[model samples]
Target chain A: MNILTINGISKNFGSIAALKNVSFFVPEGSVYGILGPNGSGKTTLLGIVTDVLRASSGAYKFYDGSKPVNEIRKDMGVLLETPNFYPYLSARQNLNIVAKIKGCDAAEITKALKKVNLIERQHSSFKTYSLGMKQRLAIASTLLGDPKIVILDEPTNGLDPEGISEIRQLIKLLAKEGKTIILASHLLDEVEKVCTHVAILKKGELLVSGDIDGTLSKKHGSTGENLTEQKEKTMMEVVSDDLEKLAGVLKTLNGILDINESEGVITVSCHTDELTAQQVNKHCFDNGIILSRLTVKNKNLESKFLELTK
Target chain B: MLHLLNIEFLKLQRNRSFLILIILFIVSVFGANYIVYEVSTNTGHIVHETSNKSFRLFEFPEVWQFVSFISSFLLIIPCFTVIMHTCSEYTYRTHRQNIIDGLSREQYITAKILYVVSLALFATILTVACAFFIGMLGNDPISFRDFRCVFYFFIQALTYIGLSFLLALLIKKAVLTIGIFFIYSFLIENILEKNLNRLNTGIENIGHFLPLSSSDHLLMFDILKTAMRLANIESYAPENAYLTASVIYIVLIGYACYYLYKKRDL
Candidate 1:
């Protein structure tokens, strides 16, 4: 069953359109990723679905669209944009408040804190937490009551390498438990790591959406047949000190599907059958450059978008 | 309603600013009464009935008026508390969190309305308790006469906090909402009411119809009217007139808060 179905949801702030006729469905038990850059309406769209925001025009429903939105929200946990607990309150206190709002047992607070490894420091004020800790606390709260679905917007944002890795592991674990997770992030790498289905948003528009696990070929109203045919493509992560130059040069390479640069690292999804890592390394070397790091994975989302719509 | 109150209580029980405001509220209530008592004692001229006798302001029924009047000023403490707490939910973005966690937009506003009502009731109960305590220390028989002012005080408390809630909802920031509420309710509204009252004093004194001024007029009891008669300044608007205005302002401001939260995006 689809966990959520959004229909023509549009939101506007004055004359600036934040979301324009955006629609997508999140399948139950799938890790859905909303991929976009900054100012791309990822957060705004999430805000609308979460009911904290009012859409100028449109409709949406959850879990078969039968229950009231408020009732539907009880079974779903969300961490939108930022950690939004009272700074003066302790982590435990914060979760206690959420527990009351959701009408769950008090033990859920302890379970949530322990899940995020914040049990020891749950007594600390939220204002005193590090960015990573604050994010973890938000995750802890999001996972309370073993929610059927979790919506996290940029869940790993502002985290160190270890912190990001930890959150990714936790998300993967949650997915293993059959909980549907909808994660929004600008990084293709983050989405590629955990998401099974992906939606690409650009400037308040849906560029494309499909599954990365090869099942999108028959998705409703999908032109994802080419996506299945392009299964041989590889995702390559390349990092160098000069990222802007690396990203700029990789675009000229033939058969590159998609190039995403973030934090001095360039991730390229390419046709591995036509473009080999050796060719990439040699091309950089011939251009008076050295390859610092390179790793290839099985597949990617946007590369599939480019392939499906090619 | 109880569940919503529990949610707010869970948030505020550990909050430092909220707790500090509660303390200040208690202290200010007693301090204001003590100041009035001291004036009545030290200066035979300052607080006396027109019969040339020094009337104890803390005796039985009069204690109700005295404490409720003090509570009118003390209502600022709770009103500021309401404004600060409500606006901080916006500042901290927890109102969004609350809605995300299964509160409908209506429920969210309902929770706030319940919160405002609780603060008003709390102030009212505290004033009533202080009245009983002060009246017990006096020689007059304990009576419920003049106790109706306590209910009017409750209405007055609702007006102040309801207006504060509206400002907090419309403003969505603690510092700006508190500053505007203080200046507008205390300063600007006063000037407006004074001028409006001057415009048509013969037709029920329109100044008493101002939002806070309507409630302020509720505390002009027999003693206050006697004192005003001494100054030859008539508070001619009857109690029922002020009562009607206070109730009307409370309902309108309460509905406005509900309407603002409903129509606007958080």
Candidate 2:
């Protein structure tokens, strides 16, 4: 079941359009990532759905078996932009305020602090926390009340490598506990690794959205096919002592769809069944070119993302 | 509403600035009472000669009026406190967080109104306690009429603090909101009142209808005039008019705060 559905949502800041007819759905128990470049309205869309900002047009609904958004929000935690809390208060005190706001038991504060690994420093003031710790405390606030859905905007932004990995692991752990997580991030690699489904937005418009594997696979022009399935055309890289001659001979093959040379390597895309390694090897040898390396490569999300977004 | 207030109070519980503001308010209240007590008791230097009836500042009904007047001078402290508390949410962006955490916009505004109400109640309670202490120490007879000033005192505090809340909501910045509030209360309103009255005798009484002056007129504390029944000096406007104007201002300010909060994006 879809947990949240946003349809035709748009926002305008006076004359400037921020989000234009943006639409997406977050499925239950799925790690959904909203991916885009900066100023792509990722944060604006999140703000609209979370009630931090009202949409200029369109509507969104949280499907929690007929529960009101307010009640649903009690079971849904959100961290937007930054970790907003009273800086004068300690971490525990801040979480205590969250607990009260959510009408949850105070014991959840301890549990949340423990989850964020801030139990030791729970008494320290929020102003004294490092940026990474501040982000972690924000994550911990979302963990309070054992929320069913958690929305984090750029959860891994501005963290050290170790802190990034720690947050990545924590997100995976939360997903393991059957919680649906909606994360917005510009870090393509992070979204690719951590998200099960994604929606790429650009200029306040949704470019594409689907399951991670399916989206990437579809972008490479092999629709509804497993990533490993050999398609009509397969990409292969070859290197030889006579790089120029290998490129010339490879272009002469009947099944060759496209060919390009880069850094002494010739990348060839050809009909999979017609242009086998044996055919390429023999043709190269017959042409006085000794093949040094040849291997088939599976496309990655980075390449597909660059292709689609570009 | 109760839950939201609980959350707001919890946030304020550990706030060092809020604590200091509360302490400062208490000290100012006591200090004002002390000064009044000293002036009333040591009358010889000012009075030139002792009369048959010794002038006592805390004399029962007069004490309530005196305390209420002294306390009104310090109303700016609570107004500043209310502005800080209301505007800090915007500064920290916790107002947005609270809505994200499940509070409706109306609930957010209601929570702030509750905070203002709480502060007004605190000020009213302190005024009544100070009045009682002074009355007891002076060995004066107390009456229900004296306690009526405490009611006006509560209304006055609510009026001022409610104005501050409205300013905070409209401005959303602590320094700017407080600055505008102080200027309007101390200078702008006074100038407008004087100038408007000077423009025509037909509307000479219009100045008394202005928010701050209207509320301030609620508790008249001219001890000398009240004791001597001076013929030349004008007495305060009828109490009902002042009370009615103050209540109207409070409602208007409260509605304005709610309207701004409801219409704006947090």
How far off is residue B43 in model 2, in Å? 2.7
- In model 2, the runs with Cα more than 4 Å from the true position are A213-304, A307-310, B44-56, B201-204, B222-236
TM-score for chain B in model 1: 0.93
lDDT of 2 by residue, A202-293 (tens): 77878778888776555433234343453445678999888887888888877888899888888987766677878888888888888889
Task: Report the poorest 10 consecutive residues by lDDT, candidate 2 chain A.
Answer: A219-228
Docking class of 2: medium
lDDT tens readout by residue for model 2, B1-266: 67777877888888888889899999889889988788767773365454555555577877888888888888889888888988888899988888888877888889889999999999989888887887777666676566788899999999999998888888989999988998999999999877766667674457877998888878776665475347644445678898999999999999988888877677
Q: Which stretches of candidate 1 lie over 4 Å from their true place?
A: A213-271, A274-310, B45-56, B200-202, B227-232
Residue B213 C-alpha lDDT in model 1:
88
TM-score of chain A of 1: 0.77
User: A54-134 in candidate 1: lDDT tens per residue?
Assistant: 999999999777788898788788989789999999999998888887878999889888878999999998999998899
C-alpha RMSD by candidate, in order: 5.2, 4.6
Which residue window of length 10 is worst by lDDT in model 1 chain A?
A215-224
The digit string of per-residue lDDT tens for model 1 on B1-266 reads 88887788888888788899999999888788778766765664543545577565778778898888876887888988888898888889999899998888888888888988888898888888888887887778999999999999999989988998898888888889889988998799989977887785567567768888888888866777788878988656778888998898888987888888888788
In model 1, the Cα lDDT at residue A272 comes to 64
